[model samples]
Target: MNMKRNSVGDKVFDCFNLTGLFILVGLILYPLLFVAIASLSEPDQIYNAAFLLWPKGFQLESYRIVMENPDIWIGFVNTIVYTVSGTLISMILSVLGAYPLSRSDFKGRRFFSFFITFTIFFSAIGGMIPLYFVIDKLGMLNTMWSAILPGGVVVLNMIIIRSYFETKIPMEVQESAALDGCGNFRLLFSIILPLSKPVLAIMILFYFVHHWNAFFYALIFITEKDKYPLQLVLREILVNNNLNNLLPTMTDQNYLERLKQQQSLKYAAIVITTLPVLVLYPFVSKHFKEGLLVGSVKG
Candidate 1:
């Protein structure tokens, strides 16, 4: 009788768990669905919507207007450049710093580890004023390097990568590689990096998102209009209400209509900005489970 009751309770608990999981998923998905639906709807219909589930008055006008703007195109190109270059530099530096920290036998390992770890907690002093002054002194202000150099490598990412290497990679395997006349560079390039695809993918996605969404850096450093990143373009459209200012002589009669449609275009831009990471997730999602398990297991 006790076993029978326990079995019934287990079944009830399982049903409740599934129900809760679906509810949580629904909570997260509903807003994105609403935004997507609103983005495709006519602005008047969208404003009327209390809870947008589908396009009330289907329209592609927002996308057309956004595409028509030349500054938007320039900013999009600048954003792509920043994201790609930033991710590459971040990965290269992160891997180099992480590998040495992974080695327990390396001299001054603790000090080096502490030094890298220290950056994670400590906020930059004088936040942007002194940084601006320093960049000006280096003559990097108003240049591409200003965006790239300030965020070369993130400390938290380095620590996670180093932890993965220390816990997952066998010291014995590295010793075997060294015996086979492999130098540190060859061992890292030929061995460790090949096996680090999952963490690297995650890092790339993280850094890409960071660089893509970065606005303040460009806003502060880049005085030149052409160097403005996509986020700055988005800011001009959304916050400043100054799309005309971006292009001084754009005297098109549809300017008011174009600005009205930016509400939908904002969400469309978000979806576009996020698409790279979304597309990438499917390719690396399977690897994450296995990779994380490997990293978590002690060497």
Candidate 2:
């Protein structure tokens, strides 16, 4: 076997590649680190933009403001409800919709597939206006259903799930189950779902993040302030930060201190809102990786 050797030019290119990679990593990681540090730093430091990679001072005043607000808790609870319920709804519809479409022997499979792909490139016949009217007629306005139903199952994601089922799951296994008198429902849940952990985990995470970050639908469809999701509440917080007196019992001097903490509060709110999802990513990261790699490449 011939020995592998790097020429001077290749060595230079390798050094450049490593330098560029380091710069790219720093670019991505520095912002997250900076935000975390700035959240805990004194407000004036944030206003002055003094904190670089590390925080200059330690302060919990911004977190205190966020924690003291009872409405923020209500928003958290509402967001959790919406995310969990919405993800469940989304997965149910996606699986049901994807499963049938994945079967090779299903009637009109090519026709249905073409129709779905067509819609991806084209708008609906009446668009958002008619869709809103239908939703209003359903009396789903101002209810959680309004958030869950409007775009529960994305066609593109459904296609991904369909491709997963079509490729990752062997036809022989399905045929064996059918021989054992397993019906469609039994085959779907008992056989296919158990084998679809990687795809399912990724889908759940995707839908959860989508629902958690959703604000536009909640803004339009939800009427009550109590019903607002965390994102909406966070937006309102930033918009009215200086005006709202966080601690009424505090003296004027202390209140002014709190006003100075407005910028810090914005950073704190970002960390607080994003922390849960960030915490969640590791648990499903392996599945997410496997699913994307497998689902994205189909034979």
lDDT tens digits, residues 132-161, model 2?
A: 788899998888888777767777878889
Residue-by-residue lDDT tens digits, candidate 1, 1-299: 45545588889999999999999999999987887777788877765678877788888766666678788789889988988998899889989998998987789999998877777788654686889899999999888889887888888778778878887777899999999999989999999988788777777776777787788778889989899888888787777766563333535796665555656777665555556667767876776765555654545
What is the C-alpha local distance difference test score of candidate 1?
A: 0.78
Candidate 1 positional error at 121, Å:
1.7
Candidate 2, lDDT over the whole model: 0.85
Residue 196, candidate 2: how far off, in angstroms?
A: 1.1
